[model samples]
Target chain A: MTETRLTEKTAGIRDVAARAGVSQTTVSHVLNATPHTRVSEETAARVRVAAEELGYRPNRLARGLRTQASEMIGLLTEEIATTPHAGRIILGAQEEASRHNLTLAIINSELNPDPEVPPVQVQAFLDRQVDGIIYATVYHDEIVAPENLSARPAVLIGARDSSGILPAVLPDERAGAVAVVEMLVARGHRRIAFAASAEDVPATRGRLGGYLEAMAAAGLPTEGLVAEGSSDARGGYTATNALLDAGPTALFCYNDRMAMGAYRAAGECGLSIPGDLSVVGFDDQAPIPESLFPPLTTVALPHYEMGAWAVDALYAVVSGSGERATSFAPTLLPCPLVERESVAAPRA
Target chain B: MTETRLTEKTAGIRDVAARAGVSQTTVSHVLNATPHTRVSEETAARVRVAAEELGYRPNRLARGLRTQASEMIGLLTEEIATTPHAGRIILGAQEEASRHNLTLAIINSELNPDPEVPPVQVQAFLDRQVDGIIYATVYHDEIVAPENLSARPAVLIGARDSSGILPAVLPDERAGAVAVVEMLVARGHRRIAFAASAEDVPATRGRLGGYLEAMAAAGLPTEGLVAEGSSDARGGYTATNALLDAGPTALFCYNDRMAMGAYRAAGECGLSIPGDLSVVGFDDQAPIPESLFPPLTTVALPHYEMGAWAVDALYAVVSGSGERATSFAPTLLPCPLVERESVAAPRA
Candidate 1:
């Protein structure tokens, strides 16, 4: 057994090689597990033992420079820092990247309509030689790919480009909305009010489509049930007020913020949640849903799942083996329903 | 002007050198703005123009390899991704790093009692040769420095180690609490009840200290005015119930969440916010404070500023200048008060 003293300086491969009584090439092959090396098992075992004893850490940057693969993935996001619930995407990607022994480098760009690639960020990532890139968004939207992004394997999370060139991973918003209505229907909500988001947003469109689809399937009239609003608390309040005129037993909101607004509206109308009215929300954003009077029953966007899948897809592309379909095949991960105290059957 | 057609391949430094009719060293010096390079201004301009014409992008990784400074800073955090408000730390760091032409790489570790540095993440950053590291916490707490972290320049954000060896940037919790009470006092509320947080947390201690200091300065009675809670909505509700018995006209909560609970408690007691009783909170965490009936008046954590400062401090350490004091000088950035609708003069 070799006694190693803790030192401020990190041990290098040369130290391991000298300690192991082996050549630097032998130490490299042993440490990297390089295939078809001429070194014997005994020599490899000695090298490993010496390396462990010396606490020798491999300089990955130097090795990556030679191999042109850093085992690092870049997560380039817009407004992720400011977005309420989008941080999970970075978490999901980070966890998955770690699982594959890959480091995820996150770069947040300013939220703007300009389509140009953030030159500094892209250049930094390129300089780092990140094996692949995951371009994620705070919301579901169409985007223009940064020029030369194709130089490295790339995938999109929560969004896609107009040309649909890169693969994407997104939450199944349509299915999520359908599930919300289906749950309400099961709870005996016949006259359901949909507090829809703005008409231009993709989530609003997808969720509204699902609301209409479910309404038709249940043989219920969709008219006067859908009220449009900006995806916010004030919008929910206004939409719920209008929907209340038609009298809805249940209100399905665009997102949790709007649902919070719905709660305020219900209070204004002298109604109690899950007593006089049952409410459902989407995106299940935290601190909002969980902190509500009676925690909100809402759809949890597949943020973590989408994030994990984005890395997996990017990895597949980087490895040059997996189903890296060139065409725009936006993979939709399921949005699971989080059952809280908000949902209840209609009044007797 | 020479018109260059876009090509699939990225134009290399070699291409720029050839186009500009300059040596590779001259091209490198001109592109990198390397100091002390004797290249004529005319030649530098010619090189820049040629490089721009060919869309030449310098490989930063290659340059960093020789320099041993990647201009990358690692942000190792625990639960920043899951935490509701901590993502701003990353944004602030990213923005600051960008201002210096550096890249911020984020790594989130699982929240656990064990304070071991995430080995894989540390290794990855080491491999990437990040010039420095900023170790940030989701919430303010004491932490253990990762082993041998001193090998590179590092700073702590929102936290500190037992040894206090590293430079730390933290929100001024004590001052924040003092400010909260001062705001209530300025509003002409004499009877202020403090819904305090748990006894053990550092924030609770710091904030309570501030409360006492402010109350002493105001010559207000400190006894029977402080009610301790678990720093949640339920805790706030419970504490408010006890404090209300004291017949206080205003309540100061440990956090926005507790303030929310105070609202419910106030409602149950037939009181309206700022109408019957005024309320103030700390850590103006979003959704809770803002979404309240009247937005809660609270102190905003200097998360963005702390993050930006951490990077600056780390940069100073990296640059080997600025007071990188060895002794623990925990830099407490000011927590500014954010006024909203929740505060008003106590009813006569």
Candidate 2:
């Protein structure tokens, strides 16, 4: 055996073949366990022993370069690492990728301020020749497609292009808001106050639309019931105080953080949850909803499912098996309600 | 341009060189904007125009294969994507890597159950020839080095190997705990109660040790002042109730989450914060500390800085510029206290 092959750096296939006293093809067949390779059992055993001795690992990249394929996917995320609760997208994608025997390479684009798809990371993915790419956003929004993203089959998670040309997976904010109101109304509450998220956010529009639709369906008055605030705990606090002055028996917050703020606001007003006022929240972010005094009842963002579906869609596109569209509409997944202690029947 | 070069896939450097009537090396020098390259202005302009016309991007992998270096780092994280607040590690690492023109490829090994380093991810990184690997944990703990990890320079983040062989970057939990207690003592509060974290976690031992040391230094009684909890809001709530019954004027919680619980408990007992009871917390986690009614006075985890330092250490080892030890000692960074509305002088 060559002294160089025994070094700490991984031994190559040529080294294994040399140590085993066999051709490189024979070693490859033996290591891959390729069917019908006609390699004898004794030779296979020798190859295995030689590989173990030399610490030989199959060069997956070299193999990929030869075959023009690597069972790997690239995930490009915007602000996921810096933002709260969005890392679940990466987790979901990783889980699904593993099930398909594909590894995921994640690149966070938060460091690059350029709105364009980060060229460096995209170039890296291209150099590696990933089978597909999934572009994810920290929050639901519209995105301008990067100029240099045409190399691989790509899909969007939690976002969509303005031209509607990209396949996108998103949470059904409208449905989630409808569910929250339906649950609250069923608990014998009529005077419902909506603490709306900021106007510019796409989720705010969808959630408000759902609230308006639900209120109209129930023939409940909507006048002077909507309180505007940013999508944060402080916003929820300020909005709740204003809504309380108008006398809402129940409050529906834009998100769980805002709901927590409402909890503190209720305490200051000398009101107890479920006794004098009931509360409902959206985006059942962990530790926050679960740690609340009453354990907030909220809608779960379909982040995990969206991530999984994005992978599936990207795989289909890469495999050329799914229907191809010039301009695909956004695929909306359900945001189910997580029942907890926050919501209760309105007081008599 | 050839028909293949005009396809959606990125055009190669050869295509640009052929069209620009220049050598591949010249094209590379022009595209990379290398400072010392002697390419003429006319030649550089021609290379740029050809690259733009053909949409050519240099293949980083092919270049890496030639140079035996990819200028890429692999980050193997356990549960960073699934856990809260830990993603900052990735963000910090990413920022530092970018500054050095090194891209980070992240793979979450938590999907794999084996305690050893995840073989698949390591193989992928090997295939791509990553310069180094950083194995990070979601929380501080001891880990078993994965087999076949000797090929690349590696370091641990937020964890240490049982053999003490791998260089580790960790939060100074003892120092953080000591700082918290010292700050409280300086405020003239001698009757302090500790709402401790779960006993099994490594942070718990360090924090408890620091608390005991600080109390002893202050000549205060430590017995009957430590109330154990599981490091959650509910645990804080339960432990705080027990501690308050002992007539303590202040409470130090294991974490921000637990401090929140303490707030609820104190509220239920009709005690106002700082007015009747002062509270301090560890791990100044976002939104939780900031959203609390009076805000929270807590110790910062130094997650971002630890991540940056780990990358620096790994780079040093990879470049052969720093002292390399078989069993390196743990590197502990400072955990400074963040003063906010939660801490105050004890009631007269």
Candidate 3:
């Protein structure tokens, strides 16, 4: 395709008016796609042609009032910096937003909200006049709408309750955990330990429940194998050490960060991954899995894909097409085990 | 602070003018902060008060033309999906831009730039009217500037050689490399290996130079240990295996991705980190130290700080306060060794 010489600096509506032998106001009305115009269709088309030839791009924001649409969505992510899964979510949301030619105005609150603290900084989105809002929760919790947020259409990501007040998209945490356990059992691993975080968050409970359900269904012992740790590596290290003391051959981690901590503790305890203690991790968004000591045997959750699905759900709501909760599903992507150096036959 | 009751409606310049008892032209001049206006100080204060009270936000792009400033910076990231470090850069730039009340327009090319692409499509930023541009390259290469980009003030990040044309802010690759090697050597490591991508690139060359310099200073042999690898975990793994074959007690990787590869190789070969082989990596931005089995002992480059600095440099140029390159010491931020489980005393 021959490159069009559309210079950054272009003549305004006055230039178009002069070329078309019409008033500047007439040219602007045609350019703005104004309603209730007395001008004939043929005349409007001529003005549009002249403006296009001049490469006069209309300012969408300025014309938003006329169109009642800015074609922009505001994404408010809580604790983007700290959340390990947020990167993929943002990436997915951006891709979907761009695909639709809609701009995403993203704002992240790194601070995790205390119960007493205000839930969100909704004012930013309000000020921007965003067409819709996607509120991605840092941790799954009871849906608490900050007072007076009902004016705009909004969607929630990772909400514990979907009362259908607004549409919500979340990962099927229970199914993900069950899949991880089933994979290890299928691999002939009898002794399986569940390493969970100390935080009593909804997502953690769901994951823990899944682990127990899987063990019960498989007719295996769940006692003495479940250990609690912090959300970070140090927590994983301590939990792994305790789990090892009880002599579990296979360890299932709640998340990638905890898995890393388990890796460190195993190293210190002289237990080789797969060879000694086969490790399986959830939320395979971490960059270290490919390079982990025994490239980790992880059950990868499609975090980015989930985010993309959320975007699609939000788009449906904003476009007035897809039904509220009907369009949104708690997407349960099957967690697949990434077979690497992490799993091997149990040491004799 | 009492939450301000937001009145949900579009408040325009005309509303502010009527409330202030001033002309629309006077309100525009006052909002633009335009000089050469003989409006009384009291009148100007009244206009400002009216604008604030009525919530009259100026249309940025149109006013940008009148003032010849957008108060916005355009950030061109090399890739947003793969390189996690680029996200940090975006965050830093966005934070700095927001602090200065400047909006940030980000465009990410996943590094697949085809020369055949038209200038208008490639330069999606042209319509945005950004006052300054920060071109953040994930890898070092000659950027094919958009036709007539020289007219716009820009700063390149992650690569120097602005080709004596535009300003640049780059991480001191040589210094970063030297620092990692020095840390490994201080821990009584002698046979240290340097693993990097194909050494033709500027970053690879600079890092290689530092490795050689450090080896010479330490009076250690540089033969057979320096190996070329890809810039990802697989490359790091292959290069590390080669380095191990060459019998290096310690390893210095080009970046975290490469270091991750080394970590995997070391695990596969039954080598415990720090005990069997000490490993150090670069660019501690993402899930490197925390995600690695033993939190990696690697260099943490200021990717976000560089982004902030790049914006500051561009601001200086746009504001016409400082020279093209505010300074050229390359901001020698010593990538301090984060002593995790990765590095240990070389086995005697």
Runs in model 2 lying further than 4 Å from the true structure: A1-6, A15-56, A111-121, A245-247, B1-6, B19-56, B111-120
- Give the distance in Å from residue B96's predicted Cα in candidate 1 to where it truly belongs: 0.7
| Candidate 3 docking quality: incorrect, acceptable, medium or high | acceptable
Residue-level lDDT tens digits of model 1 in A242-264: 89988889999998888988998
Score candidate 2 by DockQ.
0.46
Best by lDDT: 1
Candidate 1 Cα misplacement greater than 4 A, ranges: A1-9, A116-119, B1-9, B116-119
The candidates, ranked best first by lDDT, are 1, 2, 3
Taking every candidate in turn, the Cα RMSD to the unseen true structure, in Å, is 4.0, 3.9, 5.7
DockQ of 3: 0.28
Query: Tens digits of per-residue lDDT for model 2 on B1-348?
Result: 223322655678999999999998899899988887698899999999999999776665566667677677888887766557667887788778767666677777753457565477777677667788888885657777775555677888888877787888888889888888888899999999999987577888888888989999989887778898878899999899889977788899988889999999999899988788999888877778877878889998888787788788877766667766445678888989999988889888
TM-score of chain B of each: 0.93, 0.87, 0.81
Give the per-residue lDDT of model 3 (tens digit) for A1-348.
Answer: 111222546567788888887898899888767788778788888898888888776544445535566566767777676666676777787778767666565666665545345444455555545667777885765566554345567777777334557666667778888887888888888899989989998778978999999999999998999999997777888899889977888998887778888997898788888888999887776575765666787766666776677678778766767655554344444555566678766676
Candidate 2 CAPRI grade: acceptable
Q: How does candidate 3 score on lDDT?
A: 0.73
Ranking by TM-score: 1, 2, 3
